[model samples]
Target: MKIVDKIGFDEILLQLAEEASELSQAALKLRRARMGINPTPITCEKANLHLLEEIADVTLCFGILNLSDTEFDYIEHTAKKKYRRWKKRLGIDKE
Candidate 1:
């Protein structure tokens, strides 16, 4: 498929990226608020999660832009595997 054909998808990706960026900014603010003696680890963790989601969004955007179905399938599979691995490594389970 041509790049032009994917313009709508591109827009959606851009929107997702933008929202993620906003979320990261909010996370940063929350982090700064709980500095020094009373640090909120939970807030910091939420920030990290936001960052991870942003990274995933970027990865998905690139995959959508550049990969064929078979290639994208493999990429998505690998991403899911990696996400699961990272979640386990980080001890971040869904609530």
Candidate 2:
């Protein structure tokens, strides 16, 4: 958190991009390694934890990005979409 204030706007955006790429990598580890398409020796827990961390990083980046635009509609849409998807997948929804 201390490092957060030390950086500039553009640097934070760059970190956001880098974090996105890391999220992609973590997803690939789950999809490819689990499917036997990749032999990177990744456990599901490890990959999922990495994914969770990457998502946290992206959200932290958004905290900085949101300083520029308070009304970021995409954030709302994405949060709802992801929440719905996860709830459905985890059997947390009535329907």
Cα RMSD to the true fold for all candidates? 8.1, 4.8
Worst 10 residues of 2 by lDDT: 66-75
lDDT of 2 by residue, 1-95 (tens): 54556787789889999999998888888777677765677787788888899989888987876553436776677889999989999999855
Which regions in candidate 2 have their CA more than 4 angstroms from the true location? 1-5, 68-70, 77-95
Full-model lDDT, candidate 2: 0.80
| Clashing pairs in model 1, backbone N/Cα/C closer than 3 A | none
Which candidate's TM-score is highest?
A: 2
Model 1 RMSD to the real structure? 8.1
Q: Write the per-residue lDDT of candidate 1 for residues 1-95, one digit (tens) a residue.
A: 65437577668667667866776776665666457355555666676776677677665657556658898789789999999988988889552
Global CA lDDT computed for model 1:
0.68
lDDT scores of the candidates, listed in order = 0.68, 0.80
Q: Estimate the TM-score of every prediction.
A: 0.38, 0.65
| TM-score (C-alpha, index-matched) for candidate 2 | 0.65
